[model samples]
Target: MKSLQLLSFLLLSYIIIPANTDGGKKKEALESQSQHTRTKKDQQNFATKFRLYTDATKEDCQIFYNQLETLDKCSFNASLPLVIIVHGWSVDGILEGWIWKMAAALKSQRKQINVIVADWLVSAHQHYPIAVQNTRYIGQEIADFLEWLEESIQFSRSNAHLIGYSLGAHVSGFAGSFISGTNKIGRITGLDAAGPLFEGMSPTDRLSPDDANFVDAIHTFTKQHMGLSVGIKQPVAHFDFYPNGGTFQPGCHIMHVYNHIAEYGITGIAQTVKCAHERSVHLFIDSLLHNDKQSTAYWCNDIHTFNKGMCLSCRKNRCNTLGYNIREERLPKSRRLFLKTRARMPFKVYHYQFKIHFINEIPGKRIEPTFTMSLTGTKEDAKNLPITLAESINGNKTYSFLITLDTDIGEVIMIKLKWEGTAVWENLWDTVQIIMPWTKGTRRPGLIVKTIKVKAGETQQKATFCSQSIDNLHLYPAQEKTFVRCEDRFQGQNRK
Candidate 1:
């Protein structure tokens, strides 16, 4: 009986011990796998990082989320206003050079201000669609960091200004959305906000006026290619500025690709491709560097009306400075402002509308003559500027065209108009007048431009130019006439 009991105990121990050991090994393997997953997730969450730039630091200081100690180490001053710059999608994992350039510019402008560059290259350096999706997660992380700052250091949300480019603009919007009520972000400046997925979405779905207390957007590359716009076309903020009609920029033509390559080597390919889109970033930097020469945009119903030079009025907040100097006024509805920019830096250009009434002395005749105009202003003279007319000038009709000058010629004082026509047309007109002596008075078949009405966009100044001598006003082929600023006759005259 003792041997039998001992045998049963031995057998049970062998079976139970092996089973328990196998179960323990399986549990260990599962726990290890779970731990690895948790670690990877934590790393992914922490990938979005902040780099602080201040006057005190020659190099950027890394800032960690939920790490209050990092703030002090980074020389972050809660008392000063904070400007956060968020970048967009990246093909390469490395951050672009513009990030540092913008940070330096911001620091240079206001030494006391804090500039934090939010970097999410780890995720942003992926497929465009994936990078776009990562924006939401990165934005949430930014909001969490801001909340940490507010709770830890009592930083005021109103002192925070977010400047985002491309997809990052929507990211900033997402961050702003996370904070509600009195803690909303003070301002968000979208530098050519990305379009693809957000273009026709609801205001709540993308960057809108409601995203921040004062939201402004600059659209530089809204022109569609392959049925997709690189920048958002719709007004996504309280103040939406469409520079150069928000299409093909002045210097971003295909010919510039070669010029870019000459200047920047192989990398110029990317630069040329993104020149128009990246222009928004440079424009913002220009505003910081040249505050005195800030670009101004006028509120207009559409670019067509703006191009007609009818929206140059500065009355009742119709005009606002673009970029850093933008007015923070919030209207009940979005205001689409339009402005023209130059090809290079100091992009501000002077817009002018020339309204010339042409009187064709010859009956039943229309003259299609080329015009060369020069304006003498208080400051300087813009000479040999060509005026392009879409159609022939008819009798008793006013033709209005828009022109832009890179230099501010100040108040207009004098104007010179020259008419150029083909030699055949000139000879034919002279022969008709001489042969048909019995027809009408001795007046020739020429254009009689009585007055040239001018409207200055930047200054919102209007002036009238009259020929120095009424007899010389008859503009014939190869003839030039001088006009000086005269009494305002345009007030009562019809203008289109």
Candidate 2:
């Protein structure tokens, strides 16, 4: 009866407040239009948390209140620390229930900790900048709320820890940076900071500890292939968590997908409702705080200096070790090479082949050669050198060919290629230019040109360059696997 009354009051408040705006109209319309809109589960879910807050949009602000309600409703002690669970991009508030289960398990043993489930609506399919802007706003709101809470509700910054997942991690960091208004974050755990935005962007572009002292991260994975940039810098997340090698729930393809649905979807939702407040991450946080006592301290302490003296020394190191710098006068782009030009010549030499297929439809297809340009001074003849194309293609609709020419160092090779889907062998060539690298104090008289010909009805393909110049080879993206393990901090030299 009490729960029912509380829910009715909350629902009435929602209905009354926005009675004028379009939002209110939409709310009323949705209610009126509801033939079978929300399920019984959703109704029970709303009832479970409505007593704490009338506004679902302000769930993050109401999280603390929600935690207190859970304690009283479930009859738990109220003197414990608070753990806040922050969600990520494109994720709904449904995750709060999963957090609840995790929190309940921890609360079973340590009644000294409460759970706070933070939530908000982020537009789906929007890019990083959009998310960042909203997060900055939310962070400011949170900072202001915390200030008010400290003044009235008697909540101390020291008693709170924030765990932000995905873009939520970025938002949490942004919030902490702003909240410090004077630089004071208790602890920040980033579950997998959004990948693309952080990829090419500088730290100053995003949030950082330079604004707040207590900041760290635990990246589940760092690549966002679907975003503008595919790779993310390491130091972005202080202490990145690489579960199954930092991926989206590891296992076979089907198994991994299944796990995500179960873990993040169903199971996650259940836990949040059950725990409702400081879900289950408190123990891990406690361990982290215990291990890094120095970072946990106020930033003013001299004992908590740099290197080993820091609470989040690993993260500190990681921050310093991010960013990729490319030098000018060097190759700026990577490419695949098909022909190696070294000697000087008079006429323009062009070598290319393209076989087009199915180009009349809404989508088109073709198979062509890729080319690249490089200059060298090696004593190699420009003759019938094997022009390697696609090696052993699968389908019958595939194509390949090679062409060699008589030329010398310090000459121009213009390789022109066209794809017409009529025959098997479509010989093509390039426009030529004069080469004079040897006449001047230069490193080479040979220029290697690489290119790729992609067509419809075929898988994408690229031509590769091969020679032996450590510098020249390094000038482009390597064809083989190469990863250099370094300190999370950017101290060690890159090994490729």
Q: Please report the candidate that would top lDDT against the real structure.
A: 1
Each prediction's whole-model lDDT (CA) = 0.80, 0.34
* Candidate 2 wrongly placed segments (more than 4 Å): 1-79, 91-93, 122-129, 180-183, 210-212, 224-233, 247-249, 252-496
lDDT of 2: 0.34
Q: Mind giving the per-residue lDDT tens digits that candidate 1 earns over 1-496?
A: 3442332234223322343444444233222111322222354347687989765545688998777888888879999999999999785578888888888888888888999999888877765655665676676677777777888999988889999999899889988876645658889999999876677877655788988889999999887644467788999999999998997578877667678889988666666657888899999999888877889899888787777676887899999999898889989999999999998898988888788888877777676778899889999999989988767877688887778898888999999998866788788887978876544666676777888889887888888888899656688888889998888565566554
Worst 10 residues of 2 by lDDT: 321-330
Candidate 2 C-alpha lDDT tens digits along 1-496:
3442332234223323333343434333222111213332332222112112212232222333224444345432234565556665442334544345444444443546655555555431233334444555455445554554465556676566666665666666665766644536566655545554455555544444442334554333332323321113354533332322223222112223344447767544322221211211332333333322111111112211211112212222221110010011111221111111111211112222322111111112233333332222133334213333443222223233423233323222222222222222221111111222223343322222222221111111222222223233111111221111112221131111
Q: Which candidate achieves the best TM-score against the true structure?
A: 1
Instruction: Spell out the clash pairs found in candidate 1.
Output: none
